[model samples]
Target: MAVFEGTFAGDVSNLKIAIVIGRFNDLVTDKLISGCQDCLKRHGINIEPNNGQVDYVWVPGSYEIAMVARQLALTGGYNAIICLGAVIRGQTPHFDYVSSEAAKGVAAASFQTGVPVIFGVLTVDTMQQALERAGIKSNLGWNYALNALEMASLMQQIQNTSSSPSAANLPPGNETIALPKVTT
Candidate 1:
């Protein structure tokens, strides 16, 4: 049997990546950006502001991340996208709405465009938890970057693979089954 999978191992110098950040929670999102940049830089991807291989896009808040991400993905300019934001629970239900919608949007963008969109938003109960996850304890941005790399590599492999083999090339005892034709 043949198996296919993605890994965090690849030459990232030629990969084009984009990061979408929400300014609503800059305090925590900034750290996530830092961790993400560190991971990309370590993998040999240039991290310069504009001319670098990685491009950064800023949105008003997490709620807008999905729209921008979908637009970018539609451009076919980036191999993968990373979205970072923080939506802390508040007295109202605003947190739930924003976080849930952001996640769904990010997912929809990837599904519709066939691009790897990494959702790095943090939905925490408190500022302390957000800070800890952003950088104090660990940085999820780094992991998100790694995911982008692996997914991009895998996508490249999938796209570059040869087309399906013909029935004549099938191994013995594995003949192709013919479907009956129906006339409407």
Candidate 2:
């Protein structure tokens, strides 16, 4: 089997990143956003207005992240969008609905806009897990931001690659090969 994936060696200095955060769980989402910003800065990405290396937007809750994300993505100004939110499971069924919908919406936005929408939302059963993932122990938000950078660079590389191979680069008998469309 053949396997292909994005690498972490991509340059993030020139890539524009948007951070969509949820304010409902301000305690947790704040940490997540901090981690994401820290990671981007560590990789030499500027968060200035002119450079446009990073843009930050806050929504009321996780439920609204997708719509705003879709709008920003549609503008075609961002190379990647990172969503950060916390949806801790409670006694009610609200957790399931919010978490699932957020995930689906984020994915849909990415698919429809051809932009990398990295999901850093936490759907944990407890506050501890959410905090841990946010930055207490692992800082998944930072990791997610890095992932977005890698994917953006990878997609750009793939799109720039020729779908059709020249005769010289093709196999012995096959002079040409059909190239699959690499979606942004």
Candidate 3:
């Protein structure tokens, strides 16, 4: 049995997050939005701060999440982006296309911009699965929020490390110093 433990201790108080929600299944997506907000709030995040700590924008559907996320990342304003949506599989092949496209698009956006874009969109075959994953009754938003916070922290760390000069970049073995002789 494989257990998935969420172990992320990151401080995101100084970072900004952009949440792009898709309005496909309003009911399900709404719950996700609530979860995201509640989780963020629990982490000391103010989504609607007048001074701008977090920002939210609603897209038409799941397909648009990537475009919006990409735009936000490219603008270089937010430290991270969370794409939240619910695409319950339908009777047609359209389900596969939307779900896969959304996933790929989000991935592409994150890779291209070098920003952490979390994939909070739920692609389930049934409404029950979506609900279960969302932790509507079990309060699973905690997990999602943790994911966002951790990813944001990771990105920040990478950015900081890359910009700073490290010992490895210094002249080979130039860090060595002469040792003084002890009392004879």
- Using TM-score, rank the candidates from best to worst: 1, 2, 3
Candidate with better lDDT, 1 vs 3: 1
Q: How would you encode candidate 2's per-residue C-alpha lDDT over 1-184 as one tens digit per residue?
A: 2244676664555677889999998899989878887888877788664665788899999999999999988887887899999999999999999999999999999888878898888999999999889878988878988888787776665544435344347557844322223222
Taking every candidate in turn, the Cα RMSD to the unseen true structure, in Å, is: 7.8, 4.8, 10.5
Candidate 2 wrong stretches, greater than 4 Å: 1-5, 48-51, 162-184
Task: Give TM per candidate.
Answer: 0.87, 0.83, 0.81
Please identify which of the two predictions, 2 or 3, would achieve the higher TM-score against the true structure: 2
- Identify the candidate with maximal lDDT: 1
The candidate, 1 or 2, that scores higher on lDDT is 1
- Roughly what TM-score does model 1 have, to 2 decimal places? 0.87
Q: Rate the local accuracy (lDDT) of all candidates.
A: 0.86, 0.81, 0.75
Model 3 has an lDDT value of 0.75
Q: Give the alpha carbon lDDT tens digit for every residue of 1-184 in model 3.
A: 2223333554556778888889888778778777888888877788674747878889999999999999988887777788888889989999899999999999999888877788888898999988887765653445566687877766655454445566236576654222111110
Q: Report the error of model 2 at residue 167, Å.
A: 13
Clash tally for model 3:
0
Least accurate stretch of 10 residues (summed lDDT) in model 2?
175-184
